[model samples]
Target chain A: MALQPFTVHRGVAAPLLRINVDTDAIIPSREMKRVSKQGLAAGLFAIWRYTEPGGREPDLNFVLNKPQYRNASILLSGANFGCGSSREHAVWALNEFGIRAIIAPSFGRIFYHNCTRNGILPIELEAAVVHYLAEAIQAAPQQNKLLVDLPNQQVSVAELKFSFTIEATPKRMLVEGLDPIAMTLEMTEQINAFELQHRQRMPWL
Target chain B: MAKTLFEKLWQSHLVEQLDGDAALIYIDRILLHERTGSIALKSLAAADRQVRNPDEVFCVIDHIVDTLPGRGDETMMPSGKEFIQTTRSAAQSAGIHLFDIDHPKQGIVHVVSPEQGIVQPGSTLVCPDSHTCSQGALAALAWGIGSSEAEHALATKTLRINKPQSMRINFEGQLGTGVTAKDMILYLIAQYSAAGSAGTVIEFAGEAVRNLSIEGRLTLCNMAVEFSAFTGLIAADKKTIDYLGGRPYAPSGENWKQAVRYWQSLHSDAGAVFDREITIDCAAIEPMITWGNSPEHSCPITGTVPKIDSANKKSASMQRAQDYMGVKPGQKLAGLPIDGAFIGSCTNSRISDLRTAAEILRGRTVAANVRAICVPGSTPVKHQAEAEGLDKIFIQAGFEWRESGCSMCFYAGGESFGFQQRVATTTNRNFESRQGPQTRSHLASPATVAASALAGQLTDPRTTQKS
Candidate 1:
């Protein structure tokens, strides 16, 4: 249940150019009926990738279906990626499908939180930079492997270097592989103190 | 200090102020559904973590269960029964209260929360389901989160979240006839695309908004997610307190008085600043319906489906939605033939929704060409409808009278209409194949669904003739 450490991720980047890529399309609701987190690897983008019920035949036109992008580990998506649905399965699907880092202009708030918790590094970059990277990836996916260095907060491809910003807590968590609950537990005293004040200030029922 | 309603509730519940924007906020209540909440609890159990406060948690089996009468642990979906059974075991193990399929009070988590008075004004609640924001209608701070967050809340009774910026959407003027809260929300989504309110919690103000019933307010907040807002809130007032008074789980005696006094204070102070503000004239709105996959791809019922201008077809999704919907430019939204009609889902399956549908279906019959289904939102709503003979009207009109649960809201490989069946439905979310494979669903109000069922097409509810 603990997250994998994310330090320096280098892999081929696949471009999903569509904006507002909702969690449903990432992995539809029907595929999420499984209660356990296991068996989720196949459900990642099942609708877009699978031509049949169990993904017997791959959809050739889909990016993931292309042989070159089959093992891509970096996803260069358009703005507002992972919108709609609070399902963490979206992040699970992305991670299970071999995507370690996602570079987008923006992300849904819940999806961004889930990405952090699930150990999938979400890099928020400028729209123009994301668009440029997406084109670069699509043009030469095999030759252009993106190097996402979390400690340095930089992503580089061939000759282009883009610096990104992430909050301190999430950055440290990703770099050190620290558990979020463990971090929160360290502030138990502060939490209890606040509760004591809150209850005394306003206690009705 | 002047404070907006959001800030008042937020500061009241703030537990540990973390670095920058993040904080550890305490949660008063949590409502869990069978679909996603079960996964969170199961993972916690697997991790050997204990629920911090079982009394604060309430679980219900709504999402994956069959809505058919005389149903049990069996499910139509492949291993769908596992999700329900797993949740039953997980809730029991966690010592959290479970509302099983046979529980009289069981219903959609959002409907059951306020209906039972468990979600009081000024409270903060979260659920794994996105529509958890519906509880915000009662002036509560509620929003959706992922299963992992649910697990954390179960284990800690707190969530570490960055406080969102605030926005106020004021609906001024008066609502016209035949336009309900569903229409108002649809109109809002059409005006502001789905992502308009991203990273913000919206507080709806203005006279027209306050004029809506509590149920209508619930319906209004139900689609806040469609606008990409973290949640939607309305300040609690006399109506909210009166609505909560004497409910099953509401406070009694001295507690009731103190709770009411506190809830009465849960309003935005004058001159409180918000990050953004917008105003909509309610009189300018009309009964609206979705024409494409996205909720924003909508228009007034009388308006035509838009053909994207040649210069405006840049967003492939818009063009793709129009093509998938099979509606051309200049196509009339009304009178488009439908093969089925659904009248349920947490979005619009409350008692008022059933009554509205019954009014349109009093003596009429569903078209022979259309398959009409009506699933009540909750067991209590179903019982109340039956007591009032609303069920008789629907049954007499040939609508399938179903038990309470999320039936075909989004077919989880379970019971569904025929493939590619063009249907008008009351459920939210018009995404491609949401209800069933290739199913073309036109999102509308319950009355619109009823009238459409009768006409075997998308007919304006206001224009439906009396039998």
Candidate 2:
């Protein structure tokens, strides 16, 4: 299934400034009762977002629970965000919770890939730049909405504008919402050719 | 012009070098578990897609399957039964090999793959679990993938991947007494934070890595994801060849000879270059354990919790981890009381790991207050341990000897440690609430966990061995 193309997204950004914010924290295993990706929004950050385990009561101290950030469509975080686990449910939850993009200094390799495949833009900026944008968003979140321009590869909030870089393939995929499998299937000849030689070279495989 | 082992493997498996570093890589094998595999298979079927090559795909009922003796499809994880049933039907319909719950070969995907000889040198394998990198110890190119990517690999037998830069981590000297592969990796991550190898493929080399047993090498590479690396690899040697010999899926007779000859050439050239290189003196490493929620929060057993400096950028996270663990700065980890000791997971649950722990539990029983459980990585490993009377040692030592699977590696609304329980565990990942709600996990080697269980505290294995 093709994703919703994300060309330009402007939304309220919530700050979750903590380094090594791993995926397990993004969505706990207990919250994943089903095998599908839908319905994970309630489980996003459940450990911190909820007052108790498997409870619906919100933890008022949690940033996402705050009124200003309740409908947060963007997340601003520290380095190595989504650092552990290869579960794409982390990305699925963020996408379901209306998160269009995430700004961080760095990300877990697999989670970064998962973001692109899920129609969520993961922008890597300097820690200082991310902190600056986060501060700007936190001061007056309603007025200081973040505008993510995928075509230009720039993030703008308030008077600050920062340019980011993304790979050509992922950029095209995000902008076009192209199904990667269908695209790869177009090159069936090349894959078949490689497999034929691979089988002959190492019949054991 | 020398080429690194990564470059050799990359080129060999490269279906097409796309724009920039992006390439279409052929996937030789796809391993799956019930927890995440069900979603991928269900999604693929929903999209009306068929598996390109079912012969190369293998599925196992590891994750979410209860590890209790005489276990069936019912799991402690709610609705976990659906995942198993979905994967069972999907795998059977797709005509792929399915190692069901009662299959003698059933085990964690990573453990079962290598033990079954499904992973081989120069092959590229992908799984939906992060510990898939464990198989790279055999000189294979394996890495973790998301469920969608699993579906893509299932439908096309290929994936669009951006080639990662290469890095080589060299453990130069021999490991000291009580120091094992688990300690070496923990020490490495502690020295250079968890994101030390971000965006790079690490080839663990040097004397220490080569000296490690195949199981030890697997333990070392298993935590590559925790290091934030794309994957980890080690050159195949005589040890790797001998370990794979006579395995069910390995090449036989003439094919075995050809495979061996080719695998011998899977190492990096003498003067090959890497984007980055780091060397560690293995002799300096001691039995290491984590004090906080991250793998990077590790220290030697004799070390103290680090003081939080307001000026340090990581102080906030450090403080949060400390507060959650209920430990203060300057507090020593040794002799700290523990509520539980668990020995299982893809990280360290093989026969060798079990034997290492059994040596410590031979005569001594677990502390009267501590709850200790040992889950074998695979049924075969469990049988081997029983054959050697290692299970008797574990049982006699007051530890629960359970069935084979990924039990309690992470909580999934299943049987979990009590609230606020602090555990000494051999599994990877010390993330918040990983074991249970508000549970504190101290990651360490099987020896260290065994020692902690015996003493009911965080005791160094070396000290226990002396006594």
Off by over 4 Å in 2: none
Question: Lowest summed lDDT over 10 consecutive residues: which window, candidate 2 chain B?
Answer: B458-467
Query: CA shift at A94, candidate 2, in angstroms?
Result: 0.9
Query: Can you write out model 2's per-residue Cα lDDT over A1-205, one digit (the tens) per residue?
Result: 7888989999999999999999999999988889889999999999999998989999999999999886789889998999888899999999998999999999998899899998999999989998899888887887789999999999998688999998898899999998999989999999999999988988888
Residues B1-467, candidate 2: write the lDDT tens digits. Answer: 89898898999899898766689999999999998889999899999999999999999999899999889989999998988998999899888999999999999888999999999999999998888889999999999999999999999999999889999999998999999999999999999999899879999999999999999999999999899989999999999999999999999999999999999999999999999999999878999999999999999999999999999999999999999998999999999999999999999999999999999999889999999999999999999999999999999999999999999999999888878999999999999999999999999999999999999999999998632
Q: Docking quality tier of candidate 2?
A: high
DockQ versus reference, model 2: 0.83
lDDT string, candidate 1, A1-205, tens digits: 4579899988998888776777877877788857877667677777677786445487888888898886899888876688777888888878877889999878877888888888899999877798888777766788788899999999998899989999887787677776777676677687677767766655643
Docking class of 1: medium
Q: What is the C-alpha lDDT of each candidate?
A: 0.86, 0.93
